[model samples]
Target: MKKYILKPGRHQFAPSSPAVHINDTLTDTEAKWYLQRFPHIAKLFIPLPTEGEVSTAKKSKMKSNQTEMEQTSAFAPPSGGKAGQ
Candidate 1:
């Protein structure tokens, strides 16, 4: 499977930035779309965002799981709703 490492927001694609970093694994269609949208995207390279990789990725997953757990817990009553009233 191919993996992409984008800068994570609209601000990262600012015009003043020299080139938008991209992963080499991208298919032709993906590359073409990025290039068309951001003309200055110079090169496709291997393994982007080496710094803070684990923390950044894990943080997203943690938040998502936390939210899901909270929602599920809210729907499920404690101890399956005791014996009766």
Candidate 2:
């Protein structure tokens, strides 16, 4: 299985943010179509390659994941903050 992370409305005021939409593994043709359709958001399901090597598609996926992480971390509370406060 793989995932397609999509922001629901694809707009600045979109109701929600990107999340994994669990999906079947895609064939190359299907992957290409999705890449064109969603551009920067779609990525392989898991197992991002280590830093030593990568394919073109893997590079794109890593970049997308990195961007998502950065956005999330920016507004997240510090480690000592109480969860419900």
Candidate 3:
């Protein structure tokens, strides 16, 4: 049984983050061995508050960019689905 850390999106796994990948499917000894080799994984176990802060920061940035896009598009006339029209 392989284990993977996944993001909230459907059917998507995050290969990069270490905190989300711990799995019991692997034999206990094997899991221990892997963790021992990649000690950085242990360090990435983020606390709830920190995760919340990170998520909020990302949401704020996204909202800001979206607002800017909406403002810009307001001035442009709707092109009738023509390429570069």
Off by over 4 Å in 3: 1-49, 80-85
Question: Residue by residue across 1-85, what tens digits does model 1's lDDT show?
Answer: 4444444332233367744444444455675576679665533323455569878988999999999999998877678586344
Model 2 Cα lDDT, one tens digit per residue, 1-85:
3333333333211125554233433355654565676665443333345555557668889999999999999878889896557
| TM-scores vs. true structure, each candidate | 0.37, 0.33, 0.34
Q: Give the clashing pairs for model 2.
A: 2-45
Better structure of 1 and 2 per lDDT: 1
Q: How close to the true structure is residue 40 of candidate 1, measured as C-alpha lDDT?
A: 54
Per-residue CA lDDT of model 3 for 34-80, tens digit only, reads: 55776644433322346788799999999999999999987766776
By descending TM-score, how would the candidates be arranged? 1, 3, 2
Better of 2 and 3 by TM-score: 3
Measured with C-alpha atoms, the lDDT of residue 41 in candidate 1 is 52
Model 1: colliding residue pairs: none
**Which candidate tops lDDT?**
1
